[model samples]
Target: MVAQLRIYTINRGMMASWLQLFYEHIRPLHERLGMPVQNAWVNAERTEFIWVRSFNDREEIEAKEAAYFASPERTALGDQPTRHIAKIEVRVMEEVPATAGVS
Candidate 1:
């Protein structure tokens, strides 16, 4: 499985607004598109939002993400959510298999 990690730097004082939009709108769209978010977190200072998603393969990732961005639902939301983001960092990661007897 391939994992995608996204870290978004929220604009100052916009954490609540961003989270509301994400949980209420963006996340639902992701789920409907078969790209449910696995987990999410916020930095202590609330300046950053971190989330992860898993896909069966790189092609699925690319296709689903493209569809998501191009979706009519996402288009309607427009910049309402993104305007609160100051910066973003995205990483595609893989899990390392556990080694036997290696705690």
Candidate 2:
């Protein structure tokens, strides 16, 4: 199992719209693609949106991402966020079993 930490930087004054689009559109699409969101948060400044999602393997991740980006639904809605998103960072992480129980 693996987790991906995604951080999205929203354009000035666009955080609310961006988050609405993410929750209403993107999150459901991801769930349909088999990547379940584990958690999500907003930074104190509110311009950054951070979320963690789990995947079974690298191959699944790649395939699902490709499918998502290629789908017509995504193609239609993807550009809607261009005006709101400034930057995006994604990190693939693996949990350390030894520290799994630590808070």
Say which candidate scores most in TM-score. 1
lDDT score, residue 94, model 1? Answer: 78
lDDT tens digits by residue: candidate 2, 2-102 = 89999988888888887889899989988988889999998848589899999987778888889989878789895796777789999999766887889
Model 1 C-alpha lDDT versus the unseen true structure: 0.91
Model 2 CA lDDT for position 87: 92
Per-residue lDDT value at 9 in model 1: 95
lDDT of 1 by residue, 1-103 (tens): 7899999999999898989999999999999999979999999485999999888877799899899999999999988877999999999997766784687
lDDT of each: 0.91, 0.86
Estimate the TM-score of every prediction.
0.90, 0.87
Q: Candidate 1: give the clashing pairs.
A: none
Q: How good is model 1 by TM-score?
A: 0.90
